[model samples]
Target: MGSLVVFFQLAGAVALLLFGLSLVRDGMTEAFGVRLKMALGLGTRTGPRAFLSGLLATLGLQSSTATALMTASFVERDLIRGRMAQIALLGANVGTALTAWFVSAGIEAIAPVLLFSGYVLGRRKGPVWLGTGRALIGVGLMLISLALLGHATEPLRNAPEIAAFLPMLDAAWPVALLFAAAIAALCSSSLAAVLLILSLPLPPGLTVVLVLGANLGGAVSPVLATSGLGVAARRVALGNLLIRGLGCLAALPVAGLAGAALTGLALPGAGLAVEAHLAFNIALTLLIWPFTGPIARLLTRLLPDEEREQEHGPRWLDDAVLKSPLLALTGASREVLAIGDAVERMLGQTRHAFDSNDPSPLAEVLALEDRVDRRQQQVKTYLSRLGRDASEEENRRAITILDYVINLEHIGDIIDKGLAPEVRKKIGLGLRFSAEGYQELDAMFLMTQENLRMAQTVFMTRDRDMARRLMELKVDIRNMERQSAQRHLIRLRDGQPESRETSSLHLDILRDLKRINAHIASVAHPILDEEGLLIESRLRMG
Candidate 1:
């Protein structure tokens, strides 16, 4: 019974720490998502800046894995160079270590203070305050968990069972290391693993091994997540993994010496585990920072880019499943989802081309447009076969899927024929919008992208509230377009040469983006109508 109590208490403490970490990450994202994204996008111009950006982003997000995956996504978009991404992840590793060090500063008494302040701030309005408040609350919970962790483990120091097990565990350092690595991988957080190790009463040598294990395990999640992304993204993630894996291999042989050195420092409240984690990462970064180029090149050679699949009909519309309406519908849904993804890529390529004023990025848009057309057509046909004998609910779902894919097709056309041509014209003519006008257009582009993402979610879950939110965003996009046009006219009247030269282009881009968003927003229409929240006509009854 006592052993079970201890286990539960340990699990609870670990759970609270993980929860706090999650809240901090989510809060930071909610508060500073756009700015952070902008900073990351703009900050990777050089190796040093890229490292700093990665470090700062991880510090803000409290998860190296988040920073790594974000970097991977950027690589996919060709936003950040592959070498720079690897360097940035180097900083992210150190940032995670630094976070562990900060959390281990033994400030458990301030938990109440942080909790109170967080509550007060969270009660106030706005995303900034709410996010910051939630983050503070998360921090408080983390500190309290630390105290709880300490109290729970106090008995472990003298437990006869642990006393019997410690020597054997210590003797089998390789097993201990793997054990810690597995824990970190499963939890998907090295910081959590290190903290867990911190609470244990263990030999310094074994402690160092476990910390090394955690670091090694920390780099695995990103690699696994990004395995299917792209050659560039895989390189970034795999590079980080290689760095950590090699560092662990090199450190394992010297764990005892390193642990003894740390022990001799006798630093107050400096848990050997976290301190080792911090030092190990710092050392690894310093050692591997200069080798990022070589490692990136190596990863590229090993993981050559796979050939893009030419349109071979629908990848997800399995004909074998057509006998079962439900199964067929599910397959069709997946196929439409693929079309949505392709449409998203088209919009992204358009934005990239527009931003850089380079027609090269527009090259991919045409190919993606063709893919979207082929897949969407196949999906429509696939679903048409199902609804003939389908039940009412199944038929409704089929219609919903059909509606979404049609909208997606329309969006693809707007991007390919409308937005892509507009962007090319801007690039070909070398016309530049006024600063205010450009910002307006760029904001619209980002808004449309976010709406497409939300639309995908709405299509999948059919959640009425989210569907309503998606419906409401149409008003916001319309206002944004109107206000941008008004601003452009104001600039024109003010005699801004840039505005005069780009007026037609600016307005065309805005109009196309607005049209695209309208189609994307249609994903929510069926969900809202089903919930009786959608009216047929916008005209007020006279």
Candidate 2:
């Protein structure tokens, strides 16, 4: 019963620590405008530079997982080379080691002072002190959480069952190392694993070895999370394991020296353990830092799989330089332009299907429509992240363009799936249109195609004049739809022999035509309604 209480107490401490770390990470990301993903875009041109970027990013986010995931994302997108990934992996290890040291050192002792100061400052009625105060509070809670965790573990030192385990830790350092690594991996958090090791009242040498093991296990979480990603991403995760695993191997002789030095250190034993942690990481970084280039090149040779070929399909829009918002915006615009081209081609194919009576062109239109839909999704995802760094004007522009492109893609789907298939069905059944009906249908198709083109133009240029013209064309197309539907009904009432199929085809074509007009009108909506139509629609009637 006593052991159970201790167990729950330890669990509560761990939960609090995890919660504090999460809050700190969130505050830091918000404070930095969440540019960790952008910083990771710097290709591994040089190992040192890549390492530097990784260090800064991990330190900023206070989570190696965040940094590694971002790096893996870059690798998957081909934004970073395999070699850069190797260097960044090493840097991430060093960064995570830094956090462990911060927790172990005397920094945690001053938690209360900082916590109270931050609380007072955080309540100030202005923006200036709020962010700094929030950051300080994050740091304070982070420190206090660790301190509480350490205090919670004090009873473990006196418990006979726990003390019996302490002898085993000293007797079987290697076994302890592997055990620690497994714990780290299963926990999916190196910080938690390190804190657990710290909570044990073991000698400093054993703790140092366990810390080393924790570092090795830390890479496993990201690896498992991103397994089956691109070869480059896999290489990055593998590279993390290689660097930490190799460091552990090289430290075997030093581990002997570490144990001796740790035994000689003063009372609390924290200072010595912290020193070992720092020295190991610093030495590892220095030694591996120079080999980043060779390791990178070697990884390239080992993982030489080609990307799936994209022919007239939406391409992945990842670039190392897109770490910058301006650069990312440029890439997004280029992708949007590609999507626009696909939309235009789909519309053109729809027109050709009408003119040549060829279903093949309509099939091609369906394929292009698929490409447009995919590209729209890709653009929106990239833009949503970019929105963090965007100015108000840029944000508004991005949302507007995305809105227009999404609608335009849907318009293409309507033509390809709705109108084209109806036409193909009629043609396959040997149904022929009357000369007058054919002329009217062709004219309506041409006008709708023109509207699609205009929508793309207004989206790309944000030209208010073009948008206005599109609204006028949208009204004209609606009139055309009404006229076509009425004429088809008249033909059916007149008992035309083919009126059944004709009416079906006419309604499908009219639906497609009207959908295109709606999409065109949507392009102008960023500047339209003249009376806040969206807001007014939600207003309560008096």
TM values, all candidates: 0.81, 0.57
Task: Give the Cα-based TM-score of candidate 1 against the true structure.
Answer: 0.81
Cα lDDT tens digits for candidate 2, 220-248:
88888778676778778877777878888
What TM-score does structure 2 among the candidates reach? 0.57
**Lowest summed lDDT window (length 10), candidate 2:** 529-538
Candidate 1 lDDT over 1-542, as tens digits, reads 99899999999999999999999998887677655665666678688899899889989999999999988987786667788898888889888988888888999889999999989989997667888899999999999989989989998999999999989989988898899989999999999999999999999999999999998888889989997788888888888889898999999999999999988876556789978988898888889988888888888899887787776677777778777889898888888888888898898889889888889989999999888887887888788777467789998888889888889989999999999999999999999888778777877887677678778888888888667767767887899999999988988889999999998998899999999989988888777777788787999999
Cα RMSD (angstroms) for every candidate in the order listed: 4.3, 21.1
**Candidate 2 Cα misplacement greater than 4 A, ranges:** 42-45, 109-135, 262-270, 310-542
Instruction: Show where candidate 1 strays beyond 4 Å.
Output: 1-4, 26-45, 77-80, 113-136, 158-176, 202-206, 227-233, 250-270, 315-328, 355-358, 374-389, 430-447, 465-507, 532-542
